[model samples]
Target: MKKPKQKKTKEIRTSLLRRLAFLDRATLDIDARTVELAFSSEQPVSRWWGEEI
Candidate 1:
C-alpha cells in the first residue's frame, strides 16, 4: 500500500528587535510597568486618558 502526501503550510513569526529598531531608542525610556498600564488602561483608545493630555 502507498501513503498519501500531505501539504505543508507556511508559519508566520514576529521579531521584537526588528520592530524596535524602527523606533527611537529614547522612546524606550518608559518602564515595563508603565507600558503595561498604558496598554491595559484603554489609554490608547481614549485620547483624554493618555499622557498627551
Candidate 2:
C-alpha cells in the first residue's frame, strides 16, 4: 500500500524586536483602563433609575 502525501504548512511569527518596533510607532497616550471607566460611567443605568423613581 502506498502512503498518502502530507501537505506543507507555512507558519508566520513576529519577533520581539518587531513587536517593540510597533509599540514605539504608536503615538497615542490614552490609558485603556481610563477609557473603559469613562464608557462604563456614561451608561444610562442611573438615568433609567432616576426616571423610574
Badly placed stretches (over 4 Å) of model 2 are 14-53
User: What is the C-alpha lDDT profile of model 2 across 1-53, one tens digit per residue?
Assistant: 99999999999785665212223324454665222211123334445348322
lDDT of each: 0.46, 0.43
Task: Return the TM-score for candidate 1, rounded to 2 decimals.
Answer: 0.20
Model 2: lDDT equals 0.43
The best candidate in terms of TM-score: 2
Instruction: Give Cα distance to truth, residue 14, candidate 1, Å.
Output: 1.2
**What are the clashing pairs of model 1?**
none
